[model samples]
Target: MRVQEIPIREIRRPLYRQNDQNKVKALMESIQEIGLQEPIDVLEVDGQYYGFSGCHRYEACTRLGHETIRCNVRRAPRAVLKMHLA
Candidate 1:
């Protein structure tokens, strides 16, 4: 895995997840104070990025108007991506 900053618009979230507003608000404050402590995990397939976790953090950053997010990138095959989608 490699850590990098990726454009939020470039990463596709395949699953619809509901994040807690309180948690997101807290995270937004923490991120604003200290920045993101941990990078979100993402899968890279065919040059495309997909996010499967970190829903709360993602929402927090998005609400904070962040254009890019830090991610732990793992390159995977289309089959793996299909498995995630499934």
Candidate 2:
């Protein structure tokens, strides 16, 4: 998997579930201490990325005001990209 530092603003997250502040805080602490242990998965399309998983990790970084995050990017199929684009 290719690791890339993606801009936080360029990554889209699904809103199906609400983020837990407690978990986010814990995660943020872990991240601060150890750095991002695991890279998040992302689908790259048209220079932007969409996160399909790792929501908690994403939120933790967001709360930390991270400008970029390490991600495992993969080219998404046209159909999948279209789904996230809108």
Candidate 3:
């Protein structure tokens, strides 16, 4: 496993729409003030990243003009991917 500062444009979320704008704004403020306490979860396939969680954080980072983000990468069984859908 490795941690790297990835570009915001390279990150992708399976979900098409985003909700909770206010909450996301709040999180953005918090992150701006105190930095990202928790790294976002992601899965990489064929050199592409898919967000498993932290959709709001991703948006916040983008809004804050963050060039990169902290991400955790690991190898998981295919079942984990299915479970993410549920």
Candidate 4:
């Protein structure tokens, strides 16, 4: 799979609830300085990709005006992962 630009709105996990603003900010800064070292994990369902992790990274990329992200796609039954996320 290749890295592609996906809309920020498509990011499924919420970034603000982690209560690690300072750390998140620092990580974002680092990502901006050195670029994303790790691609976020995501799963495709019904033709759309939903993030399973890296919510902070997603937010950081959005703030940095990134239109797309490098993602590691995992193919699985949505019901199983949805339960995991829930």
lDDT (C-alpha, whole model) for all candidates? 0.97, 0.86, 0.81, 0.73
* TM-score of each model, paired residue for residue: 0.98, 0.83, 0.78, 0.74
What is the RMSD of candidate 2? 2.3
Scored by lDDT, model 4 comes in at: 0.73
lDDT of 1 by residue, 19-78 (tens): 999999999999999999999999999999999999999999999999999999999999
Which segments of candidate 4 are over 4 A away from where they belong? 1-5, 14-16
lDDT of 4 by residue, 1-86 (tens): 55555666775662335636776788789988999888888776666677757877877887778887878766667695667677
Candidate 1 vs candidate 4: the TM-score winner is 1
What is the alpha-carbon lDDT of model 1 when measured against the actual structure?
Answer: 0.97
Candidate 3 off by > 4 Å? 76-86
User: Which of 1 and 3 is ahead in lDDT?
Assistant: 1
On TM-score, the leading prediction is 1
Candidate 3 per-residue lDDT over residues 1-86, each given as its tens digit: 77877887888777676658997899899998999988888877657777878888888888899998999876566666667767
Clashes of 4: 2
1 or 3, greater by TM-score:
1
State the TM-score for model 1. Answer: 0.98
For each candidate, how many residue pairs have backbone atoms clashing (under 3 Å)?
Answer: 0, 0, 0, 2
Q: Rank the candidate models, highest lDDT first.
A: 1, 2, 3, 4
RMSD of each: 0.5, 2.3, 2.3, 2.6
Best-to-worst order by TM-score is: 1, 2, 3, 4
